[model samples]
Target: MPADLSHIRQVMEEADCLYSEAEVEAAIAQVGERITAEMAESNPVVFCVLNGGLIFAGKLLTHLRFPLEASYLHATRYRNETRGGDLFWKAKPEISFIDRDVLIIDDILDEGHTLSAIMDFCRHAGARSVRTAVLIDKAHDRKASPDLKADFVGMSCIDRFIFGYGMDYKGYWRNAPGIYAVKGL
Candidate 1:
């Protein structure tokens, strides 16, 4: 296989999407609007689920006008592999969020395992309010445990793997400016 986007493109062959840069920017603005209106100005803490949420967080922050703090935690469904492996709670945020409004942001909401876990963590940390935001919300299996329903959802996507706009395939495509669905893996 060739080096540039081969393995990645193969994985995306069935993805069937080609979002433009302008479209992505528009979505971010929409998410920011919801955040600004729904979230309070009481020192809200935006906790990003890293590796994918970094780009989304940055873009969302730029559009958000109110005062807010940011932090990140490393949650991995893949550990140096190209597949979704066991979910691991690795690095935890050191910021203080007790009695504060907390928002967990991620790139996509699939099985909802990681986000659900983080939501549970926020409760344990004494967050007065906890919410979730995601770029894509798929038709997740309802019986796959209770999903951490995102308070804010940008788009309702079919159950398909996607990359771009901060999403990735085998750690690639994270920097893809627009959201794209590859043909196959």
Candidate 2:
């Protein structure tokens, strides 16, 4: 069933604000600075791993003062559901990754499935270097790929159901101004 507006509202109301808008922005600024320092001279192709990564990529890019190109990849594991499943590729980057420094940006790095898969894809496409970045890195030990982690992380989130600031609940609340942890989930 489609998520109703009232349900979304209730979820938002009951959720705990883990990070306010200002806090999130500050974290993004830090991530941007770090990215600039590390990859500014590399001329990286910043690839947003949509659709959750869209907001983060847009916000973070504004703070990055460097020469770079932008693209997007639409690979999903959670298609509007709480549980994850097999990977699905809705779209892929059009730019050639051969000998290019590739930066994959996403909202949350939960299990390392989607992000790790994307990184492998870039390498298979002949990328010289591939790095991952995330807005929130869930503090848990249940990652599907336990050895993988984000290269640049804005903040650490509690292991729980989360929404807001590009994260979502059943395809809603991605635009909730702050990062939130859902209550009773």
Candidate 3:
């Protein structure tokens, strides 16, 4: 099936801008500073959760002054849809993170199921420590667990269908300059 380009454009046209580009940038910088403060000397292996994490990781990496090994993994549950299903691993970590501090970066922490699973994988693979950094943390009560939280968070947003800065809506709008919520989502 082909996507309707017109509808895609209209989605953006009608969407509500949740965060401007400058606000997103400021949030990223703040998160970068916090990550650097804690993990700069940890010799961390930073893994960007792909598709959604691409943009956030690229921008956040510049703020870290210390040296770190940067890599990416493609694990997703949404698969370009609004709702999530089972976990799908397009790519797994190819580099050895054994006995090293691991940092997982993603665009958002919605329910934390995928992120939680990734963190568990790191621990089972012998990571000395596993942490997470998310560009946006959705404020809701239905988390994967009561204690599930990102180690570093760039911003907090209400539970809405949001996209931009790596997040997508129906597999589009990931490149939108700022955060936006679908009109009725």
RMSD of each candidate? Answer: 3.1, 1.8, 1.8
Order of the predicted models by TM-score, top scorer first? 3, 2, 1
In model 2, residue pairs whose N, Cα or C atoms come closer than 3 Å (at least 3 residues apart or on different chains), thus clashing, are: none
Off by over 4 Å in 2: 78-86
- Residue 155's lDDT within candidate 1 is 75
True-vs-predicted CA distance for residue 100, candidate 3, Å? 0.2
Off by over 4 Å in 1: 1-5, 9-15, 77-87
TM-scores, each model vs. reference: 0.84, 0.94, 0.95
Candidates sorted on lDDT, descending: 3, 2, 1
lDDT of 3 by residue, 1-185 (tens): 97999999999999999999999999999999999999989999999998899999999999998999999998877788888888778999988999999999999999898898889889999999999999999999999999999999999998999999999998999999999999999
Which candidate has the top score in lDDT?
3
Candidate 3 regions off by >4 Å? 77-86
**What TM-score would you give candidate 3 relative to the actual structure?**
0.95
Question: What's the residue-level lDDT of 123 in candidate 1?
Answer: 91
Compared with the true structure, all predictions reach lDDT values of 0.79, 0.90, 0.94
Consecutive 10-residue window with the lowest summed lDDT within model 2:
78-87
